[model samples]
Target: METKAISLGRSLSVPFVQELAKKGLISVPPRYVHTDQDPPIISLDSSSPQVPVIDMQRLLYEDFMDSELQKLDQACREWGFFQLINHEISSKLVGKVKLETEEFFTMPMEEKSKYVQQGDLEGYGNMFVLS
Candidate 1:
């Protein structure tokens, strides 16, 4: 089978929000305001939109496999992300990771800067590449 590389056009350089915040600007600059974009679609119903949920238990069972797979595909297409349930990873481990992530975010900028993205999108930095 022949394979082709997919290109996302180019990497878009965005103004560093930290530097902008340091400037103490009262309002967001007009350049950052996207007036051309349509307003977000909000449902009027009392119930809120939910993050797609995919249960691994259903996926593992023979009878539910096909339907679960379809749901997973739909979730990926419509929501871009989904909350995974019945994943073997314990809640304790999840909590530890969450706490560590929060602590990392709370670290001083000088400390965080040590892990700043150098070239490829692997470390802490703005990921605003325009396609």
Candidate 2:
């Protein structure tokens, strides 16, 4: 039996930043740099903006569940991502994953292109853009 391939949307092929950096250019390509857009939120105070952190331990408790869930929602809405703390995953396993990901990225462009996002959501290229 054959498995069906899945695709979220089509994405335009773009050069990798690693390839661009290899050129040793002093300035980034204008297309790669955005000069016009300002951040959506600006703080008057000097404190720097921070990514929200969602504590898994707190989420597990009845007393903290509601508040923690709200934090998770706010994190997704405002920051798009958040740090997950007290997850208790094996550090060794996390390290291995990190190493493997680094190794994959270090692979030559030709080798990496084998997993190219060919009109699919699951591959190596950009994920959100649709053509």
- Over the stretch 1-131, how does candidate 2's per-residue lDDT look in tens digits? 99997756555666788998999978877666656755556667658677699999999999999999999999998788999989999999899999999999999999999998766666887876433
Number of backbone collisions per candidate, in order? 0, 0
Query: For candidate 1, lDDT tens digit of each residue in 1-131?
Result: 99875543455776656668888999987767788776555887757677778999999999999998998999998777899999999999999999999998878778988987656567887555452
The stretch of ten residues in a row with the least summed lDDT in candidate 2 is 32-41
**What are the Cα lDDT values of the candidates?**
0.80, 0.84
**What are the runs in model 2 whose C-alpha is more than 4 Å off?**
1-8, 35-46
| Residue 85 displacement (Å), model 1 | 0.9
**Candidate 1 CA-lDDT value:** 0.80
Task: Write down the TM-score of every candidate.
Answer: 0.66, 0.75
Q: Using lDDT as the measure, which candidate wins?
A: 2
